[model samples]
Target: MAEKLTDSEGREDLVYIKTEDGSYRGWRVDLLIDNLSSKMEEKILLCSSCKGMLRDACFYEGDLKCGVCIPEGVAWQPVKMNREIVSDKMISCPVKKRGCEWSDTVSTVMHHLEKCEFFPVLCPLGCVCLDGERKGKVMKLERKLIPKHQRDSCPLRELVCEFCMNTVKGCEMNPHLEICEHFPLLCPNRCVIEGEEGTRQVKRRDVSVHLANECPLQKVECPYWIYGCREEMERKEMNLHEREFLHIHHRLSITDMKQKQIQMSKDNKLLEEKLDTATERIVLVEKNFESKSRELLTFKQNQIETSKQTIDKLEIATKKIAFLQNENESKIKELSKVKHMEDKLDTANIKIENLEKQISKKDSELKSIIEVLYSHISLATGQLEWKIKGVKQKIENKESSYGDPFYVGLYKCQGNIEWNYDNTGKVVVAICIVKGAYDDKLHWPIIYKYTFILLCHINSYYNYEITKQVTKEDLEKYPNSLKRPTEMRNDGLGTRSLISNTEILEAKYCKEDSITLLIKIELLPAL
Candidate 1:
C-alpha cells in the first residue's frame, strides 16, 4: 500500500522494499511526501469508555472501540506512523579523541555533546592567559573545564591589589592582601570601651602611629595642665591622677568656670532671645492647660451620665452572664469527661511505649546472643583475632616486654628483642640473648625451640610467624638462630616474614608513618 501511494518517482535508488524472506533492507529516504491524501477526509478515533484518542480503531460487539476499550476476542492491526529516514550515517563527538564517550546520528550528536561531561569548554573569562605551567597560554578547546572546579575560582586569572598597586594572580591575591604593608589593618591593642573591646582599622603602614600615638591607651597631658600639674599619663591614668589631686583640680575647674562665665557674658543678646522664646512657650502651655481643664470637666459629666446607663446595662448583662456561666459549667463537665478519656489514652500510650521498649530490648538481647554464639563458633575455628589485637597492642605499647627481656627459654631463660629494617626496606626484627643473660642460673648446652611471631597491628588474623625447632647439636651448628654458647655470649634469633616493600608500605600494619608489629618470644613448651 505504501508503494501504491508512493511519493518517490526520480529517487528510485533510495527507495526500499521488503520481501517474504524478511531479510534486513533499508535505504535513505531521498524524497519526502508532499500533500499526502488530499482527497481523504480526516476522522479521529477515540476510546469509547475513556474518551482518549486512539491510534487504531476496530469494531467490537457492533460498536467501534479502541485497543484499551476493546471487548473480549476483538483485535486490530495498527497502521504504522510513518517517519522519513533523514540519514543512515552516525557521527561521533568531535571530542572523541579527548575522551567523550558519545556516538549518535549527526542530528543528535551535537545535542548529546553539548551536555556531555567530557565536552571541551573554553574559559568564560575570554582571555587565553593562564598562570601555571601553561603560563600566559591556553590549551586546546577539547580540554574540558572541570565544571565547577575552575570557572568560579579560576586561580590562573589575574587580579590587581587595591592596596600596594601590584598585580597578583587570583590564587595569591588573598595572601598578598594579608601581608601587604599598605593594606588596611586592624588595631591589635584591643582598647576597652564600656567593657567591650574596640578595634580601629588603619593602614598597615600607619599601625604603629595608631597604636602608639592616636590610640585611647596613648598618654595625654592632664586637664589641669596650665595649672602647674606636670603629669602626662594615659586617659585612664589621667582620670586617676585627677581624682588624687581633687583639690587642685577643683580650683582649676572653678577658674575654668569663671573663664567660661566671661565667655558667656559676651552672648547676653543670645541669652535674651532664648528667654523670650521660653516665655512664649510658657504662655502657650498655660492656654493649653486651661483648654484641657474645660475638656476634663465636660468629660467627667459625660462619664457620670454613661456610668448611670452602664449600671442598668450591667444588671441585665449580669443575668446573661449567669446563664453563660451555667453553660460554661456544662462545658467544663464535658471537658472533664474528655480529660478522663485523655488520661486513659495517655495510660495506653505509656503502656504501648513500655512494650515497644521491651520489644526493642529483647531484639537487641537476641542479636547480641546470636553474635556471642557466632563468636564462640569462630573461636573453635582458631579465629583468635580479638585476643591477638589486644596482645599486639600490649607489645606495641611496650607493656608486654618492658623491664625484663621476653623469656624465650625453659626455666626463666631470657632474650632481648629490638626492631630494625634492612637495606631493602624489609622489616627485620633481631632477637638475641645477650651475654650472661640468666647464664649463672642455667646449666650449659641450653636447648629451646623458639617461634618468632610478627603480629599485624591492623588485625589479629594476619600472623607472620616462623618456628625453629632447636636441638643441642643443631644450636652449635646454626649461624643465625640462637646457639648454645660456651661462655654465654650473644646470638641472633633469625629473621621471619620477608614481605615485599610495596606490600608493606600499603599494609594496614603501617601506623603513624611507622609499622606497629608484635613480636612474641615465648619459651617453647617442653616435650
Candidate 2:
C-alpha cells in the first residue's frame, strides 16, 4: 500500500523500501514513483486464485501470518521482505546529508559524490590531510621526522637567530649572534624611550623607568612655549643653557679675522710683484723715450730741409702764376671785345633781314603786275581777232552792186576820272562822258538831230522836256566818261544822245575802220 505523507515543512514525503532490510527512508517526493511502480510490476507475480485481485491475501511482514485468521494466542511478527529489487544500484544522497533524503539521479550521481562532504576531500599538495591547516601540521611533522641527511636537503631545516632573526645553518645561531647586541639581556630598566634626550644623565639600569617618567636629557621638537622662541632644544640643562647663551658673533669675528689675514697676505704678494714689474717697465720706457727723441730730432732736420726746398719751388710757381694771370687778363679783354662784336653783328643781321623781306615783297608785287598785264594783253588779242574776223566776213558778204563802204569809223573816248576815298581807306574812281566834236563833219550829226527831235517829241508827248543835267565842270572833273558809259546813261540821256556822245573823238573813229577794236583792262597798283 502506498502511503501519502507530508514532511514538517509541508513538502510531499516519499518512502523508499530497501530490498535487503525492508527498511524505509523518507525523501522529497519526485517523479520516480512511476518507475518504482513499473519495477514492482516486473518483479511481483500475479496470483491465479483471484486473477491478481485477491481480497484476503497472505503477505509476510516478518514471518507471521495475519492475526485475524490465525489460532488464538499467536503473536503478529514483522517481516523483512526483499522489496522485489529492481537494480542493485548504490546511489548516494544528492543533498550530502544536509538533512535531505534525496538520492542522486543516475546522470549526476558521480558529480555529486565528488563534491559531497561525506566524500573525504584530500589536500591538493598531496599531503595526507583534509585541509590547509592540517596540511601545514603534516608538513611540520614531516620536516621534524627527516634525518640529518634529508634535513640538509630540506629548505626549512635552517635555524634563524632569535635576536637578529637571520637564517643560519642548524645549531649555528648561538655562535653567529654572539656579537649581536640585541641578544636578550636582563635590564632592570627597560629603556623603552627613544631619542638622544631620553638617554642623557640617565643611568643605564634605570633608563627605562626614568624615560617613562623623569628623564630630562631627551632631544625634543620645540613646543614654542616661550613667546617667540622657535628653536629645538636638547633635554639636558647644559645643552639648553648652551643654546640660550652661545656667542655667535665671537665665532663670526674669528672667521672674519682669518679671512682678512689671508686676503692681506695675497695683497702684499701681489703688490710686491707689481712693484718689480713697474720698475722694470719704467726703466724700459725711459730708454725707449731717449731713443725715440733722437730719431725725432733727425726726422725734424730732414723735414726742415724738405720745407726749404718746397718754399723755393712755391716761389717759382708764384712767378709763373703771375705771368699767367697777366696773359689771362689780356685774353679776357679780347673776349669782351668779341662779345660786343657778336652783339652788333646780331643787330645788323636783324636789319638786313628786314630789308630782304621788303625786297621780297616788292618783287612779289612786280610779278603780280606783270601777270596782270599779260592777262590783259591775251584777252585783248583774243577780242581783236574775233572782231576782225567778223568785220571781214561782213565785207565779203557785201555784193558788188551794193557798194560796200570803203571807210568804217570806230571811236573810243575816255572821260576824265575822279577819285574819292571811302571810310575804309579804299579809293574809288568815277568817270563821266563829255560832249565833243569829231572829224570835220559833226560826229553823229544824224544821231544829234534825232536826239533833238526825240527830246522835243518826248516833251510834247509827255508834256515834259528832257534837259542836260550834268554840267561841263562835272564832265571835265570826270573826263574819262566814255570808259564808263553806264555813268553817262544814268544822266537821263536818250539812246541817240549816247551814240552821238561816243563819236566825239576823231582818233577813235579812224582807228575803228583801220584796226579792229581791242579793249584791254587791268588792275593797277593802288596810288
Off by over 4 Å in 2: 1-248, 341-527
lDDT of 2 by residue, 370-389 (tens): 55654443222110111222
The per-prediction tally of clashing pairs is: 0, 19
TM of each candidate vs. truth: 0.23, 0.20
- Residue range with the least summed lDDT across 10 consecutive positions in model 2: 445-454
Please write out the lDDT profile of model 1 over residues 1-527, one tens digit for every residue: 11201221222231233323432122221222221233221122233453433334455665444454444455565433311122223445544444556656534543575577665455654445454433565432433465443555666667779888899887788889888989976666655445556566678889887766667767688878876567888765766787789998888878888888888987987889999999999999999999999999999999999999999999999999999998998899899899989999999999999999999999889767755654443212111111222333433343322223443332233333322233343434444554543344443344444555545666777756666655555555754345444444445554534454455445565554455444444343222
Point to the candidate with the largest TM-score: 1
Candidate 2 residue 349 Cα shift, in angstroms, is 17
Global lDDT scores for all candidate models: 0.53, 0.39
- lDDT of candidate 1 at residue 380, scale 0 to 100: 23
Colliding residue pairs in candidate 1: none
